[model samples]
Target: MNWSGWSIDRVLILFVSLAYLVIGIQVTMFHYRQNFTHKAMWIPVISSPIFLIAGLILTWYNAPWVHTMFMAFMWFGALAGLIGFYFHFRGVGIRVGGWAMRNFLIGPPVALPLMFSALSVLGLIAIYWKVR
Candidate 1:
């Protein structure tokens, strides 16, 4: 289906991109609060489902680059969630160690959103590029 030269695949990509963007915003806001310290949170409540749905959409559409990007984004989100869990349990004497752990703990809030934004820009470019 085409909507004024926009194909359904492009539309789906746009939707997935927007979903990630919104999720990124929510997670970043939560991080800014510095308040995930006490809750037994295993995942980012907002981003997990949003990204899950976006992943499903990308898979269904079979868009190669977008789907790969979504998988990478999900991996990052999961790693970030794991770091949060480790931090939460650390207060009770639990410990975790890995070289990447430090990066995960410090980077997700900024990196995740930028990834989503980049995906959005790519989708927009795809939507507008001349279909030869």
Candidate 2:
């Protein structure tokens, strides 16, 4: 239950928080126009699976069933967010030559991450309590 003297629960907390932090950064970047295109959106979408896989591997190492289940829920929530972004981008792509397409791209980059981060935070807290 310990890794380098840290409890598995603590590691889970750290990893989950780090994931949220990354998501927050992504949201902020999009909100500020640092990354404002369909191509840039893929950065987080591609990185998410890496986070999920790392979390799951750690969970398996620790054999925390509740934590694992919580992670599964978090993964599902993330997937939903990705799907929302996809649709949002799809909408923009359909109107690529139109004047308002730029405005449409802005919504998903910020909104989807915000929604997903809230859900993931709740899920992480639940898992942390369960494991503790």
Candidate 3:
């Protein structure tokens, strides 16, 4: 209701946030359903979707606080991704490759979380600009 001066910037940032949420959900669900063996690591996989959902909810209402909320979610997601990557590379031994090489057995690992981190950082910058 308080959408005072909605502009392209706001619209774009909001769109990016929405895209982030959707992509995150898709990745999380696909990973969960595919890998039933890694029960312990599922927490990080599962928590991301919830964060994205919260980000979507807060962003939808055009709330001023959305920036801070998103900051929290994105940062958490980023941290989780970093930790996941470390463990995967160090201990999990999951194969990594380009998108073209991806198959049923090996999904994109490093890229997804890295993408999340990069996009979230972009989202944060966009939020800052919007607030400024």
Candidate 4:
């Protein structure tokens, strides 16, 4: 673990952190437009940045506690995304012409949450994987 204490994992984690920032802003804006009708809507808005900060912190500080906490949060985020997918999917089903293409397109995006989960998974991989 030389090269100024950076490796492929660190770089991937950094990328994921920045990505969280971008997705966080987008979710914030989207949720804000809805006035955050449900309390759960606040989950991603708050946790996303935490993920980003934790990840970014990891890029600089290679501490055991940091790694431990980051691992926990990534799992949390991954689960949140799955839960969100259910919510979003249900939301679409609630709309007119339920399960139709238009509802799928016009209702809450179902993919975003899954994407969120995927990103968390990627970070988890970067955290644990051995690049050889």
Candidate 5:
């Protein structure tokens, strides 16, 4: 690829979009193992594609509508991740060991949800930050 007029924010948005794709796959597999016991498990799986597509569209056109849609999804993803963190932490507490390190290690990934939120924040920064 020729390096020409790609701004840093544009590149960062695309990178975040790709990261969503990877994380989506991982989430899907993890949920599948649990048989997707609850519908909430599908939230991140579905939203991942929304963010990825909107972000990729922004990279191509970046129309005002696209920007708004992408920004909305980013915010949704951020909130969902936060909620997921709480749920995952509760899962560990409810497990056999009851909040022990072993339960945290084996019950649910307590930090993965925070990672999801961090990625969404990165995308938001890319979209909202004014490069000077």
Candidate 6:
């Protein structure tokens, strides 16, 4: 979709939905295996909100004031995911070396930089569109 003219509400909804999907996957993994170390599980839990914050800041930097509001809403949703992650991790001890950790180790090296770059590009586009 053309995110430039998209309302903040829509963007927030979309971001939240994505966050939910990620959290849901994590929960499902936990349910199926029931054997993740707290440390492994907490990586995504902690980093997810940080990712949202980064996205929000990028949005604010690039988009209009109205869009910034939506970014805030998205951030809130991400915060909820963080809380859920915290609770899940609290109950479950560290699983040490496992799928989660393996992914964690690999994800940042690959996915994170790509995600940041994509957000950066999106922010630039938002800014360009706003200025135009």
Task: Estimate, for each residue in 1-132, the C-alpha lDDT of model 5 and write its tens digit.
Answer: 764788989998999999999888888888788888878889988888888888889988989998888888889889999999998899889888698998987887888888889989999999898967
Candidate 2 Cα misplacement greater than 4 A, ranges: 1-4, 7-13, 18-63, 94-107, 110-132
- Runs of candidate 6 with Cα error greater than 4 angstroms are 35-132
Q: Candidate 4 residues 1-132, lDDT tens each?
A: 566766889999999999999999988998998899999999999999999999999989979999999999999999999999999999999998889999988889899999889999999999889856
What is the C-alpha lDDT profile of model 6 across 20-110, one tens digit per residue? 4465455445534645443454444454455455555543454566455545544443344445445444333334543375655532233
lDDT against the true structure, each candidate: 0.54, 0.57, 0.60, 0.92, 0.88, 0.45
Candidate topping lDDT: 4
Model 2 residue pairs with clashes: none
Superposed model 4: Cα runs more than 4 Å off: 1-5
Question: Mind giving the per-residue lDDT tens digits that candidate 2 earns over 12-84?
Answer: 5556646655665665566456354556455455555555554555555646674575577576666656665
Best by TM-score: 5
Question: Which pairs in model 5 have colliding backbones?
Answer: none
lDDT of 1 by residue, 1-132 (tens): 446875655565566555665665676566557665545332455555666566556635757776666656655664654565455434333324433566456533334435444544554454445656
Off by over 4 Å in 3: 1-5, 33-36, 91-108, 130-132
Q: Worst ten-residue run, lDDT, model 1?
A: 90-99
Candidate 2 lDDT (Cα, 0 to 1): 0.57
Q: Write the per-residue lDDT of candidate 3 for residues 17-58, one digit (tens) a residue.
A: 676667667666756666745563675556656665655665
Query: What is candidate 1's CA lDDT for residue 28?
Result: 56
Q: Over the full model, what C-alpha lDDT does candidate 1 score relative to the true structure?
A: 0.54
lDDT score for residue 22 of model 1 = 66
